[model samples]
Target: MRLVRGALRAWRDSFDCGGRSVAMWFPGHMAKGLRQMKGKLQKVDCLVEVHDARIPFSGRNPVFQEALGVRPHLLLLNKMDLADLKEKSRILEQLKQEGLKNVIFTDCEREENIKEVVPLITELVSSNQRYQRAENVEYCIMVIGVPNVGKSSLINALRRLHLKKGKASQVGGEPGITKAVLTKIQVSERPVMYLIDTPGVLSPRIGSVETGLKLALCGTIRDYLVGEDVMADYLLYNLNKHQLFKYVERYGLDAPCDDIESVLKRVALKLGKTRKVKVLTGTGDVNVIAPDYNAAGYEFVRTFRKGELGKVMLD
Candidate 1:
């Protein structure tokens, strides 16, 4: 983690979208999932909105607030292990000002802070008179979030903690792993609680190109949709801005670099990520070996996601 102290070169103040559209990334399935979730609001007792802790401010689908704001809402910022939450109090304060009073940081894979989820939901639901279904003793809460924010992992964690059961929802690293709203899966036996798991959905239009890039970096949006080269460049700019120089040692670089091309070239050569390319010569057509920039970009993004480069707050 060596830091180069000198006159630093200027990085990109803002990213250009290059006339790229985010509409293509918002598929038809996400729209259908939103509709289905809205239709199930009558039976829902609470709304558990999950999101990546690294991106707490950006990439949340505003449609959830507009359509499902009637119920008691709790925001679960998952993947705390990968986020740098030194300013957690400030983040919470900002969220509270935005009308989100309930927020919890959790890591579902390690089951960290898993016990607090049910109790918090119980308190919120009991305090609200709207959910007073006198005839029913069971609690039905709907879990919603954008794609690839560990919504399914949270459900499985609760089930394992309370019921000693296996997974009921499919888990994956990519976005849109769960395609549709699933049936209510019972997670607790004491208060008779059942959770409805919904597929991850994104807004039809993102707030801006920067927000979209943040979403892509956090795996909310697919890498191919945003282009790996562009995402890698943004990631480099962010790491340099935050002074997270761990990538330098991890990739065997002597000092911090401001250029993505040089960084990717070194990464490709070190990892042996190369491909054969056809070349035109005076002698005849020839094939030459060249560094695979795409492969290097993919690896760079992967390392950041896995926390190898160090924890960061991308918001």
Candidate 2:
């Protein structure tokens, strides 16, 4: 009942604010979601799948393909500013091999990039419609991606183009900010165009069901949780598989003969460990006086961002 009321209120508010009639279909299950929108899917004609340029594979919602089955989709890779340039080109090539021709690299924050989007979308929509403007034909395009990839910001920018009301919320954070179901924004003087902004989806790793669900919801193991010593252990274990040891040298961390415990002890010394070995190991309820745990954590993540841990995709 609450969801229904919220949807109605949103619809009414959007309608009053120069928006054409719009309805949102909340399809929680991928299969059911696709089926519910099948009728509207025929009218959609064109679809736009937005993904974070950093982790394109990770940012994608698998259900998008199911919903947009057999329909034309424009893959907009946004947030290039935060991504590794080398990976972008590699992923783009991979997607091309998958038979996706309509892919555009964009940083939607820029005016030039925003300008390019509408035209590209317009052209795609026109092509899908065979250059014919059918009566009462409503053009619909859905924007989907992982959390904190700037979908709201993109919608807000698009709203600026149309000069509409009902502002899209400005989400500020590292990632995973937007939580609403779907937001429908409309253009004033068009064929009643509709833009659907769905909730951001976190990607799941290939693992046990519980682990996958946790990754998909909270995210894939935040570095801050395990502290630097433990984080370094995980990174070393993973990167050593590919013979990447520059990470330790980069952070000035001692690479003590590939012994995880030995390296942890070295890290503790660098961090000004005041606690005794018994305390550190919790042998006698001794307080582990690691004063620089936070600093160590930052350094570890910094090294990772610098690619010292090799080409690791934390999806």
Candidate 3:
């Protein structure tokens, strides 16, 4: 990576949001999900909030805390395999300061730390007051988070780990996979534990544009809403800032670059992700090959999302 650093242009000190507002995509389904979740909160014993480990600090819906804060809460930062956690201690400290004392970093794919979830939830619920359901032995836990942060995967993982069962919930790369609060699925036979899955909700009012971009980059939000090209550019800016030049080697670039176009051009050419366009020649219109910037941007963003570039800490 250092081989490309000497010739690399000065990295961006700060990202410019370019007067873009935080993507406020609280669609009807999200609003409906929130209402349904609140309506069912009375029966829920605990709230297990899942989120992308890459952006642990950003994009958490404040509405969850305000409306459903009465229940025992456990924050699960899912997809830990894709995050840079050199400062995990600091992340936990900050979360503790913010009143999220019960936090767990999890990766559903490898089932990393999956076994600890039940014990931790049991402890948290046992220590806290269970409101009106004190006599109930079966624990009902609700999983909530922004879209595409592995809410369904966590439920499926728990079911697979504890019950030795197949998928209990649907998993997808896009947001809004679960449109409503799903029927509670039994994950454990011993404790009689059940989990409720809900559609990922976004806060109507985000903290900042940078926070929104981070969420978008993490696939918590739709790519089209943020514009693929712009998302790719912002991603490039971030990769350069962190000195993560895996793109240089992956895309066969000579060195790390600050310009998004140059890097994407190489990506498009190498991947053969080009399109045909008609050029207005003097004699007549002729077809020509043009690098598909939008497709290249989409691929770039998706590659990062898959953690192929490198583990990144966007928060």
Candidate 4:
């Protein structure tokens, strides 16, 4: 799709979160899951943190890092297919400065770079003296990440690639799919490897609204928690900032848009998602067709999640 050539318009430099907080999305299950994960960490060999590649620098649950940082760690930035990774080296350099030397960019949907997982785990485990003393040949690994960042998808992909097995850990689009620490699922047979899939955990105190919005945009948090309208607005801001205008073609807009309500209204009408609402007038209340902004917002968000709107890096 060709983006229309139009005069550059001034877009909002930043998004106003309207005094919102990320405290709303921290459910009881998340805290329970974190405690449960620590209990089983005694038997774990490697801790793999699967996070969204789009926001490599944001929304990672610091609690996980603090509690489970003792083990040999691997940072697997999943969902690379949906991210615009124009400068991966820069991202790597930043992570390296932050003392993260083991990081892999992956697309669990297509199982890209999945084969590297088991080997890397093997190397990390072998190098670490703590886990290397194990008597059994079978290696038990643990998977951790914030919600909806493809933890289950990565496990399923590894199983598919290594063991030719199906998804033992259930997968879902919404957050908190795996509410508790799951039993070990086998993904390899040669060296006898197993993976313990844990619930995706978010930072108890989300740093700021911008960080929350980025996580919400990546579907790490629920839409209603962040107000779909504003989430869509922030998304629009990000799309324009990144110069990713695929939404223009997707929504049949004549040009790029800054107003999220207009874009969502267009999406609602285009998708035939209008609803009839009663309006009070001088005469009486009359039914009028109105665009379903919630539905449109959902569709717009889902479209971006599916990578139809374009590759975006929301960090």
- CA RMSD per model (angstroms): 2.5, 16.2, 2.2, 2.6
User: Distance (Å) between predicted and true CA of 217, model 3?
Assistant: 0.9
- Which candidate order results from sorting by lDDT in descending order? 1, 3, 4, 2
Q: What are the per-residue Cα lDDT tens digits for candidate 1 across 186-239?
A: 999878899999999998788887788899999999887778998999899889
lDDT of each: 0.90, 0.53, 0.90, 0.89
Best by lDDT: 1
Clashes of each: 0, 0, 0, 0
lDDT by residue (tens digit), candidate 3, 16-130: 8889875568899999999999999888889999999998899899999998889889999999999999999999999999999999999999999999999998888888854
Model 1 lDDT, full chain set:
0.90
Query: Model 3: runs farther than 4 Å from truth?
Result: 1-8, 130-136, 283-286
* Cα lDDT of model 2 by residue, 5-114, tens digit: 22331111111112211122222442333444454555566667666564555535566676455766788776655454666567878888977777877765663366
Report clash pairs, candidate 3.
none
Please provide TM-scores, in order, for all candidate models, with all chains considered together.
0.93, 0.58, 0.94, 0.94
Looking at candidate 4, the ten consecutive residues that score lowest on lDDT are 1-10
